[model samples]
Target: MLKSNIKTLIVIVGPTAIGKTALAIDIAKHYKTEIVSADSRQFFKEMEIGTAKPNAVELAAAKHHFINSHSVTQLFSTGDFEVEALKVIENIFEKHDQAVMVGGSGLYVNAVVNGLDEMPEIDLKIRAALNKQFDDEGLEIIQNQLKQHDPEYYEKVDQNNPQRMIRGLEVFLSTRKKLSSMLSSTKKQRPFNIIKIGLNTDRAKLYQSINLRVDKMMENGLLEEVKSLINYRRDNALNTVGYSELFDYLDEQVPLDVAVASIKQNTRRFAKRQLTWFRRDEDIKWFEPGKPESVINMIDQELKKP
Candidate 1:
């Protein structure tokens, strides 16, 4: 049994389509606590089908925070999320001793678990120039530049994300320092105890799941949803895998079938990247997605520590 005075934050993390959401809900219901979403893609109100957000049934099962809480036009950085999520967790703690946080966005998850690093002040003009370059020369130009300047970060970052590529380039241009070098390894201490759980499976099975998910999204009108957001195609939020590929189809840059194939391919690559990021954190305990009882038992054991 958990102590009455102890407060714990159960962090659920894994690759996309790996059952993080279902497991998170189970844990939240078991602990009788609310959920704090760390998924950056699910924060936008306009993005629905493509983001694979929790359905009505899941949301009804447990109270959730930060889902559909921001607009695509809003500039909600990781630092902004860190501040807001901590407040949400604090609020949940007022009513219950535990809160659940879950997402596949490694950066956002890390922001809440370990505070963001202090970045050097970047010149507004530098960012403007980068954005102008992206508009005129295309993301390829900016991506190649970022790759040349900061190859370490280039390897890990989602190459499809223009905003991320631009940020890395702008930091190097403004400070003459690689963004990867500036990222400190220090983790900030949080007031509440944190138990991190990771879900994963064999690569072949995971890829099959991702492909099936993309097909399901198409069946659920992901193309129509992407069409509705075409006017905002340039927005950073729409530059993601599913939306971007469809945008390419609308632009006559690729066939619909080709676009769908790209989405699956990119999503599989994204899952690989998520694994790379989370594996670096030695605190996380891994489990197969099929075994929830083991995860709960492990969490119960960890809660008894110290």
Candidate 2:
């Protein structure tokens, strides 16, 4: 039996561009519960286009929590998300027995469902110093240092991701502690039964969809969107796959075509990493993307069980 029986809430998770939002909306409407979005990028109000935030019609369909709800300037973390999501769930359960939580961000989802490892607050001075190092010494130099100090973290992390590499090194430099040590500390129990439903399809099909989506984003003035947020380019929220490439283009570091290509490639790689992360979690119930009725029926039976 599961540890807690305080009613089972549904969580629909998968890779980006995998259609989690629509399915989650359907389930929320059927169950008459609000949705607590776990997509880390969607939390910032200024990041709609790049984050692929839910549309007006979807928001009107159900009470969506945490989508475009916070400012980019605010400090947000998985631990903070866990606390806020639980509060939302508590309020939701008061009106309905269960609610739906959905998104592709594995860490945020895990933070809510299981819990997050305790992490120290990052000092702005440390972050600024690291940012300067990235600017002057370049990412390769920092990455090599991390590889030397904590090879385990370097292997698992996206070496191209400055935000992640900096955070890892920050923990190490501040406390003389390995990033893995801090990250693997412990897990706390939550007071709800989490029903995880994952969606996936053929790899080629998924990549094709991602490429097409990138093209659509460009058509929808994604470049213009990124241009407007140039001031906040250094913000963690803008460190995502789509915006980062265009930021490079705008900086004259890369050509327009090259940036667009990088977006497609990076998005594909991100999707693969998302699948790998979720696959490591054995409790997730997997399914192909196009089966809402079947998926809900399975959850309905589980929820109705005595």
Candidate 3:
């Protein structure tokens, strides 16, 4: 039985195209609560189709926060999200004893659940120099530097994401401290109880789902959507899987078929990275995507704990 006085945050995490949004909606409806999205990609208003945001029906099924909350032109960092999401959760707690948080972005989720460590203030000049180096020397140069300086973060970071690579580099250059080493080892306590549920399936099945989802995105006019955002192609938000591949296609770097195939391949690899990150969090209880009842029972079990 759920205690009336105990508030719970049900965190739904998993790889892309693994039915997290659907499960989260059902859970939110069951608890008579709202969902707070931690998916960084879905936060941008311009990134609808490619990000696989909740459809109109799903959004209507339950209230959601942070989906399409920011414009791609704005720089919404993890720290910003941490502050905003906490406020959103606190607001939800005022009305309901349980709230749902769902997303696949590991760092953003970690920021909310574990709290980000205080980062050393980076020098603007240092940041400018790094950006210039990226423009002149290219992503490979910065990626190599990060690998040499912070191998641990290098292994986990999205290597294709120059922004993340530059962040790791700038932190090291500014403070002489490795970015990975600066991550908080200690978990922060939240006022509400947290019930983390991870959704996953067998490897082959998950890969197949990712591939199919990419095909669905293509059919849903992802190419047209990417073309609409061509003006913002250089933006950090577009430096992601779906948009980047289509941008390459537009630049004549690859054929359309090849670009679509690359999206599938890259998405599969991304799912693997997501699983790796979530696996480290022993607090999360794993379940198949089809099993929401089991998840709810587990949430109930956790809520009843003293």
Q: In each prediction, how many residue pairs overlap at the backbone (N, C-alpha, C within less than 3 A)? A: 0, 0, 0
| Residue-level error in angstroms, candidate 1, position 186 | 2.3
Clashing pairs in 3: none
Q: What order do you get sorting by TM-score, best first? A: 1, 3, 2
Clashing pairs in 1: none
Q: For residue 101, what is the lDDT in candidate 2? A: 93
- Candidate 1, residue 291: the lDDT equals 80
Q: Please estimate how well model 3 matches the true structure, expressed as its whole-model Cα lDDT.
A: 0.91
TM-score of 3: 0.96
RMSD values for the candidates in order, in angstroms, are 1.8, 2.4, 1.7
Candidate 2 stretches greater than 4 Å from native: 2-5, 120-129, 147-161, 174-177, 181-185
Q: What is the alpha-carbon lDDT for the whole of candidate 2? A: 0.84
Model 2 Cα displacement at 84 (Å)?
A: 1.2
lDDT of 2 by residue, 41-156 (tens): 89999887877888999999999999988988787877789889999999998888779999888778877877767677667788799889998987788788888888766655
Q: Poorest 10 consecutive residues of model 3 by lDDT?
A: 1-10
Across 158-193, the per-residue lDDT of candidate 3 in tens digits comes to 777878999999999999889988776777888877
Candidate lDDT values, in order: 0.91, 0.84, 0.91
**TM-score against native, each model:** 0.96, 0.90, 0.96
